[model samples]
Target: MCRQIHPNLAKDSVGLGGRSKETINRKWDELAICLNTHESGATKNGQCWRRVSLCYILLFILLSSLIDNFYNCAESYFSL
Candidate 1:
């Protein structure tokens, strides 16, 4: 006679598999974007682009502020 598995196990297994697939799919998309694949068709790609752009802009602003501060200090020291 064949024994039946618990119903809860089946449900949990299905949920686990779905989560794994979603994680793998996200990784693949990131790799594709790294390779410069077509990102226009994907909703996730739009969010990725926005996040990347925001990060770059913030970095640029940070570096510019540091440079300005350095220049101001140099000018002040030379004027003294």
Candidate 2:
């Protein structure tokens, strides 16, 4: 679902952004139709996609594999 909307980011395309809003809207509409056709049970309303941004949230994470040992470093670095 997401990959369809942001194909360049998902696949690492290096293109600059100048595409019109209508193009993005059409992509969302097409994706909604495709998902509906597959019986995936996701929302068929393309507008629903605008309400959530899983990709943007994922971009905020930087800890990854270092989280388990985070406290070990923090113990000596902080007064907590």
Candidate 3:
């Protein structure tokens, strides 16, 4: 990721800090909470459960591809 995440994760994760990344995250969380207090559990996406899960699934696919590409490049580099 853009920032380092915990290397070892299990079924759940908890952000370890008193504050958020910045003001942007704060505002995003606020909007999400205002929109769906319990339905979406106030996720950062600010969308309903279905939409939010869709977004994350799409993101996972995209990032997985990117990581694959990075490894391919690294293999080529090492072969040189």
Q: Per-prediction RMSD in angstroms?
A: 15.5, 5.9, 11.0
Clashing pairs in 3: none
Q: In angstroms, how far off is 68's CA in candidate 2?
A: 7.5
Ranking by lDDT: 2, 1, 3
lDDT of candidate model 2 versus the reference: 0.56
Top candidate, metric TM-score: 1
Error of 2 at 32 (Å): 0.8
Model 1 is weakest, by summed lDDT over 10 consecutive residues, at: 1-10
Compose the digit string of candidate 2's lDDT tens values, residues 13-49: 3343565555666666766666667655666465565
TM per candidate comes to: 0.47, 0.45, 0.44
| lDDT by residue (tens digit), candidate 3, 25-59 | 44444555555555644444533443565578889
Clashing pairs in 2: none
lDDT of 3 at 12: 22
lDDT of each: 0.56, 0.56, 0.53
lDDT comparing candidate 3 with the true structure? 0.53
